[model samples]
Every structure is written in C-alpha cells, then in structure tokens.
Target chain A: MNGDLTVSAASKDTLPTVFGYIGIGVAFGIVGKAAGLSPLLVTLMSIITYAGSAQFVIVSMLVTHSPIFSIIFSVFLVNSRMILMSTTLASYFKRESMVKNILVGTLLTDESFALGMNKLNYSDNHLNFAWFNTANVISYMTWILSSLVGAVLGNFISNPEKFGLDFALVAMFIGLLYLQLISDKSINFNLQLIVVGFVLVAIYFGLIFIPSSLLILLVTLVACSFGVVMKHAFF
Target chain B: MPSFNFVLLTIVGTGVVTWLSRITPFVLLKKFQLSKGVVEFLSFVPIAIMSALWFENLFVQHIGHLPSIDWANLLASLPTVLSAVISKNLLVIVVVGVISLGVTRLMMGM
Candidate 1:
C-alpha cells in the first residue's frame, strides 16, 4: 500500500469512462425530470440501478404506468449482455472471491466493461479487482452526480439536442469500435461483422413489433452463430 | 403522478433485476467449465453488441420505426467516423462528432 499518494490503474483507465458517463447521465436526468420524475428519485435510481439504458426504460415505462413485472423483464432482457461481459471479464481477475466478485459485478456497465475488455484483449496488463472496482466507483459517482445535475437543471433546457449531447454516445461507440478493430492483427477487414450487423439491422427495421432490447440479444446470438459457422465452413 | 410507493417498487425492482443479470455469470462460472467452442463464440459478442447498438442509434428514430434519413446525424457521423479511422483517438473522435453535429444543426436551422 502507498503510504503517500498514488493513482491506481483503475482510476487512470476510467478517466474516459467518467466523461462518457457524465454525458449520458445528464441526458438521462434531463429526460427523467422532463417526464415528471422527482429529482431525488432520479438521483436515487442512478445510485441504485446505475444502468444507463435500463434507467431510460424505467422513466418511459413509469410515464405510461406500464406493468411493474413487464418493466423488470424488459430491463433484464436489455441488460442480459452484462452476463456475457462478466463472463469475458472473469478470466482477467487475479483472484475471484465471492465478495470481490459481487462488489465488482455490481458496478459493471457497458462502457466500463468494454473499456476494460479492450485493455485486456490488446495488452498484457494484469487486471485486478481493485482496478475494475476503482473504475466502477468513479463511473458510478460520475453517473449519479451528473444525473442529479441534469434533473436539477432539467427545467432550464427544453431541447437537449441544441447542445448536440444526443450524439455523444454514438460517437463514443464508434471510437471504441475503431479501437477494437485496429488492435486485432488476425483480421484485416470486418466484412463478416459488418454484414452480420447490417443484416440484423435490416431485420430490426422490418420487425418493429419485437422489443429492441430483445432484438439486440437475438442479433448478438445469431451473429455469433453465423460468424462461428462461417469460420468452420471456410477455414 | 404515481404514488411514492409505486415508484420506489419500480426502482428497487429494477435495481434487483439489473444486479442479478450482472452477478449471475460471475457466480455461476465458478462452478461450470464452458466448452472451447462456447468461448470462441463469446469472443465475437462484443463486436456484435457494439454494432447492434451503433446501428440502433443511427438508423432508428423511435424504437419501432425506421429513421427517415437523419441527415444531421449522417453528416456529423461522416467526419466523426473518419476521425476514428484516421486518428483513432477517443477525444478527437468525440470532439469532431459533437462539433460537426452542432455545425450541421446550425446550418439546417434545427
């Protein structure tokens, strides 16, 4: 332990995540507050759930007074990717104690998971629970605080798009995809990934009745299968 | 407005379900040994999920409806994607995207 002062790898690695979370969190807060949710409630949801897309679903479903069970189910389906993420991450942890895994898993979100996995996939860094936990805590605080700010200032901003915050996450994901694609040496062109992704996108467009969350899950499943099947068939 | 109790239940219920999804894999993987084929299949999940999310944001306006050629998003994304491919820096990509989107919105009087 550092008797003086030192920055951990988790904190350093999560700096980008802090920025990403803040943008999305404020957007969530503004939308929640605009939908008539109390600021305190919005903040509490951020603290407790800490899931970005699911929180948005909660706010919309609340406005419509959708059935509670259905809301939970939708959130579960949307977040099912967390399972795959955690599975991928489990191999990186130095020691996976029950308590450590529980605490670390509690803080898992898509962005942090993606960033951490990218680091693990490309580099030889020794990822520990402390690193993942630190990223988690920083990201958690960023989201809660930003969402609170958004909720408090929700009345002041009528159109979030005027500031161009709406496109923030899309830009972040594009950057991430680029990073992942360049790091891999085996594959030159992502023709297979792009083809599979576009095919699923077309299906999603055609089947409007299916829930987007469920559609994402199905797309992932089918695409992975297709990728594996093609790999087996050709090579 | 819905009662406080109802909102609380919704939030708590949501938190529980979400946490369960996050935790279940870590807990269960301790006991189970996944097959080699399964791991290989799982490797592609990240790219798949990321692409699905990116397309959803770009091509879909509402959850159920197709986007009617979101010119602003499209135009902004061009430079943004170019920056990502060329610079490969997160900050640069994000800045280019936001500035481009802002400029497009201004030019279109959005």
Candidate 2:
C-alpha cells in the first residue's frame, strides 16, 4: 500500500509538469506565428532549438534580415548560460547510459531542469534518466504540435499581438525568477541589487549599440562576477 | 526569403550545436569527476544568465534607443508579476500576464 501510494504521488507530481509544458508550448507557438515564421519552420525550431529565449532571438533576427554571422553569434551568446545549467545537472546524471544521457541533455530547458531537480530530491530511484527524458520528450512534443497549430491558424488570428502573446516568455521567466528569489532568504537583497545593476547597464549599453545581444552578454557576465565576489567578501 | 538549403543548414547547425552544449558537461563530469567547488559555482549560472536575459529585454530597444517605459507595459507588468508571485503556476501566470497586457493596452488606447 505504501509503495502504491508513493507511485501514485510520483505520477501526480509529474502530471503537473507535463501540463505546464503544454500550456507554455501553446503560447510559444502563438508567439512564433506572430513573429512571422512559417508553421513548418516553427515546428522544426521547437524541436531543434528547444530553447525559448534563443528561439525568440532567432525569430527577431530573421525578421530584421540580420546577417547569418550575427544570428549565430547572438544565439551562442544568449545560450551561454545553458553551460551552467548543464554542468550543475551533470552530477545527477553521471551514471546514465551515453545514448540516454545525450537524448535527455538535449531537452534540458529551464523548466525541465527545475522539475527534474525536484523529483531527484524526493525519489531515490535510479531511473533519473528516464524521468528526465519523460519530462523533455513531453515538453518537446507539446511545443512542436502546438507551434504547428498556431502556424496554420495564424492567418485567421488577425492580430495575435493584440493578445500580448509576446509577453508570454517574459511572464514565464519572471514567474520562475520570483520562485527562486523568494525561496532564498539570505541573499534576496544582493540578488535584487545585481538584477537592478544589470538592468541599468543593459539599458546604458543598449542605447549605444545596434544589436544589444553582445552588450547584454557583457553586462551579465560582469554582474554575475560582481555578485559572486560580493557574496564571498561580505555575505 | 531564405533559401530552403539555408533554412535546413540553420536548423541543422542549431540542433548540432545545442546538443553539443548540453552533452559536453555531462560527459566531462561523468568521465572525470568535477570538484565540489566547481559544482557549487555552476549552480548560480542559470540565475545569472536568466537575469541578464530578462534585464536586457526590459531595457533594450531595437532602434538603438532606450526602451521607453510605455505605461501599458508597466501596468501590464505589475499584474503579471503579482500573478507570478501568487499563483506559482506557469500557465496561470502567462495567461494573466497576457490578458493584463491586452486590457491595459486597450485602456491606454495604444
């Protein structure tokens, strides 16, 4: 009975994550259509890029007819943080099969990482790889299918922008940020200061720059370093 | 319009590079154990990157100008932040945020 309860609870926990992905996926698809990408291309992007910020950057760049080099460089800059996410997650996935690890890693977005990390803490199972893959695959499929739907129906939507679909990504990030910031009791002040400082710097540089991607990258790295140093020196 | 070959290559390149970034850390850490200090440092990277991205979007402008604090955006952002804090659900937060933005825009006659 205890084992069955645990199984049920585990399944229940995972269901919300899948449902959350579906909702975000639909929003992403609608945003993709508004951004003027074709349904097939958006579907491909949802499957291939999978990173929401990078996809937004890609679409924005495509709309502007930016050079190929700029597009690639911007994607690289925006995604550099994934290096950190992947590195931290490595400890949890060290023992998985190579093929499984690769497949799972490909789907390790911020949402999946948060969900998988929570499940990891509660369960002592060795099927970490499976759980991670399940979350990723479900999220990936949701994104692709919904993007296709949005693309096809995009024409009839008239002005989806009127719905403020663009802010969907921002809302998702802010929600995640709120959760993380609220949970950390000690360093909330420092985190806010760092965020504000970065925002100011991004604004300053943005005023002078044509493509703000590189400037944002520089300000972020500097702010991160400053925060780390401050945490060590004072806190 | 971008040629089909160009689109294909872009997709392939993005997939290949993204996969490489995801896999490298896992492979390296597994084959050779990472230090505790390194892991601890890495834990903060996501927040750092996320902050940078979020901050940039809120302030950066397309025409090499400062992002004007359009009242509609600010009003919409307020409710969005509130929903995010109270709901703790991604879907609810996004839905409320989008709706708020739309309603605020209409109210502002923008």
Candidate 3:
C-alpha cells in the first residue's frame, strides 16, 4: 500500500478519544499542580510522557519525594506494556518508511494504539499514515491543552482535598483498571484479572516491612506471572 | 515546587525512557512475532500493572507500617467502577469519580 495521507473517517472516529484525553489529562494536570509542579512543567510532562497512569504515578512519587532513579525506574515499569503495543503496531506498518514508522511510534499512547489497531483489523483503508497521525495529533493536543488549563486552574484551588482532587488519581486508576478488565469478554480473562488483583493486594501488604518503591515493581512482576500461569491453567 | 532543574531533569528522564519503550520495536521489529508464551506473559502485564497501581492509589502505603485505605478514594471507587461497567468510557468513569469523591468528603466533613 502506498503511504500517501488519507483523511476520510479518521477525524470522526477521533472525536470520542479526544474527550477522554481532555478529561483525564485535566485530572493529571490539576494533580501535578497540587503536588507543587508548575503549569509549564505539567504541560511539558504531558507533551513528553503522553501516558496517563505513568504521569499520575510520577506525580505521586514526586509528592512523596522519591529519588530520581526510583522515579525513572517507575516510569519504565509503568510503561513496559508500551513495548508490546509498539511491536504489535509494527506488524501493521508493513513496508512503511522508517520516518513514518518512527514518528508514529514516538506518538503512540494507549488510546492511539488501541484506536488505530481497532481500525487496522477491520479495513486496510482505515489505517493509513494520515488517519493514524490525525488521531494521535488530535489526542496529543487535547491532552496538553487540558493539562495546561488544569494546572493553571489548580493555582486557584487553595483546598485541593475538599474538591476531591487528591482522590482523582486513585479514581482514575480504578477506572482504568476496571475498563481494562471488562474490555475482554472472556470469563477466564476476568478471572485472571481477579487473580492478579488478589495477588497485588496481598503482596502490597508487605509494604509495612518493605519500601513501596521496591514492592510496587516486585508486586507487578509477581502478579503478572500469576496471571500468566492462570491463563494456562484456566484457558 | 521542585527546583526548575529537577523538574526539567524528570521531564527529560521519563520522556526519554518512555519514548524508547514506544519507538524501539517500531524501529527494530518487522512484525509482532513473539513466541506464544512471551505474548501470553506480556498480555498479563497490563492487568498486573494496572491493578497494582489501583491498589497503591486506593491504599496509603506507609513505610515500616501496614497500609491504610484512603476512605475518600475507597468511597469514590464504588461509583467509579459502576460507571466503568455501565459506560465503558473513561470520561464518564472519571467524571463520576470526581463527583463521588467530592460528595463523600463533603458528607464526612474531612
């Protein structure tokens, strides 16, 4: 397939994700601001990271005064799934030029990858460079703009707690996790999630004796192994 | 606020690391050809990671002490999970979360 820009239904499909990005991005920005990061830095973080859960976790770590190494390590761990997404997306790129592939890869986010991949399996016409890039660009801009607004708005929020800004991150995570669990319809998949969920909380109980920085990473790996094991056993 | 330099460094550090995770396979891999076992293992990573993140946020992890649940977050999660189930939409779930937490704290007077 030739790689000229095509723009048919892409814009229409991107509208819903734009709304999601704006909402969550604003939540992240306000939380970042309340954690004492500047509006510019919050917006910059959005531009650079383009990840929802990772940025929120980073803000929480920053609030706790986590070391730089720990923070960087968390970013990698939190985003390790991106590697899989990139590899899967690469399969769809076929013979596309390196420039197109690299640029697309750099802009990949959970939403962009899911949306683009959703279309690719349905129709070859749905995933040209133009359609995919339009979706990514739209989401990227909405996220950054919303973050900037949220951070600026955060300055006026003398009491972030009363407004429930502190709980937003927790809520966001739960929302995302629940969404991930339900996205697949298989009962075994749900059971896998439940297995991982139990493993996670059970290991997190060790936080009393172990530092969370270590526990978080360890718990994620162990829980995933458990999930994979259950996948073999049940499915 | 953190020092400008520290903030800048964090931005750059996370950016580079995260960017690498996103771009490396695109540059190197020609296809998604991981072994079945590897793919299955990788598939579980998000479930593991996201659940851990959710649990951590819902509970206050105290060093040298057992974790305590954040009542506000715990309270908000009921409605948030419901919204996720009903709408399967991020925007709806998040909006429900913010409002639920705000209402819970208002009632608790915390």
| lDDT of the candidates, in the order given | 0.75, 0.63, 0.71
Off by over 4 Å in 2: A1-38, A59-70, A114-127, A184-210, A215-217, B62-67
> Second chain only: TM-score per model?
0.85, 0.73, 0.74
Tens digits of per-residue lDDT, candidate 1, A10-64, equal 5666675566677778888899989998999999999887789889988888889
- Name the candidate, 1 or 3, with the larger DockQ value: 1
Q: Candidate 2 chain B, which ten residues in sequence have the lowest lDDT sum? A: B39-48
Judge candidate 3 at residue B105 and give its lDDT. Answer: 92
Give a tens-digit lDDT track for model 3, residues B1-110: 55778877988899999999988998886544667666565555555555665676667777777788877777888888888788866556667777898899989888
Evaluate chain B of model 1: give its TM-score: 0.85
The candidate that achieves the highest DockQ relative to the unseen native structure: 1
Error of 2 at A118 (Å): 6.4
For the second chain of model 2, what is the TM-score against the true structure's chain B? Answer: 0.73
Q: Score the docking of each candidate (DockQ).
A: 0.59, 0.49, 0.53
Compose the digit string of candidate 1's lDDT tens values, residues B1-110. 47778888888998998898888888777667778888878767667766676666655445556544667887888998999988877777877877888898999999
Supply candidate 2's per-residue lDDT for A114: 55
lDDT per residue (tens digit) for residues A69-185 in model 3: 888998887777677667756755757888888888888887676556445434643456777778778878888998998899887754545766555555555655665565544
TM-score of 2: 0.79
The best candidate by TM-score is 1
